[model samples]
Target: MYDLTGFQRDLLYVIAGMDDPHGLALKEKLDQYYESEIHHGRLYPNLDTLVEKGLVEKGTKDQRTNIYRITNRGQREIEARRGWENQYLDESATPT
Candidate 1:
């Protein structure tokens, strides 16, 4: 997670939520979340980054589409991030 860029983090979250997330599906979901069109130039490279980092595992869904899944490392990273975020959120809400 510390090694992950913002785009890679988003990709991890998206992959975790989906069963067999492919490029197009990932792009669509990201576009909706980002409220902008996700171009091929941006999406694929970030996905590759996740694969390189061992946070995501890639596989072919059929003859064409390549699917992605979050690995155990990815899950641990997500949990770590959530815990880090909770510390800030909790402190922010506490009376000064």
Candidate 2:
């Protein structure tokens, strides 16, 4: 997790929140969050990085669509990251 870029970490969080989201679905969510288009060249390669790191698992949904889900390791990483953040943030503090 520490080795991941901020964009990759953002991708991981989005993946954690959604249920078996496809690449385009993840892109849509991120595009909304970023208030801009998330190009495929940027999206897919980062997704592949997460897959390679064993944090995300990719599976085929059908002929053309592939779905992504956070692996157990990914969930653990998220929990750890939250704990680390909590140490420095007040309980009432909210990200903007």
Candidate 3:
């Protein structure tokens, strides 16, 4: 897997958590997590990057909205990240 920016990884996790997640919904979810407004300038381009990387698929939700979904490759990448995190957690949990 390639090294992804924190924002890109967050986008992937958000998309993976939802079905047919639209841009607005993603913005809202991120805003809630970040406790600040997420501007469209930052959101759409990162989404496009995920699309270019084959980690996300974009489809028309309506005339003005685009929906996003995580691909199989994205899922595998997330799982790998989770596994890596678990290894660190396990190591931390071990008594010295």
lDDT winner: 2
The per-residue C-alpha lDDT of model 1 at residue 27 equals 96
Worst 10 contiguous positions by lDDT, candidate 1: 2-11
Candidate 1 lDDT, tens digit per residue, 10-81? 889999999978999999999999999999999998998988888899999899989999999889989999
Sorted by lDDT (best first), the order is 2, 3, 1
Number of the candidate with higher TM-score, 2 or 3:
3
Tens digits of per-residue lDDT for model 2 on 17-75?
99999999999999999999999999999999999999999999999999999999999
Task: For model 3, name the residue pairs that clash.
Answer: none
Per-residue lDDT tens digits for candidate 3, residues 1-96, read: 457889889989999999999999999999999899999999999999999999999999789988999999999999999998999999999999
TM-score of each: 0.95, 0.92, 0.94
Native-referenced Cα lDDT, model 1? 0.92
- Candidate 3: RMSD to truth: 1.0
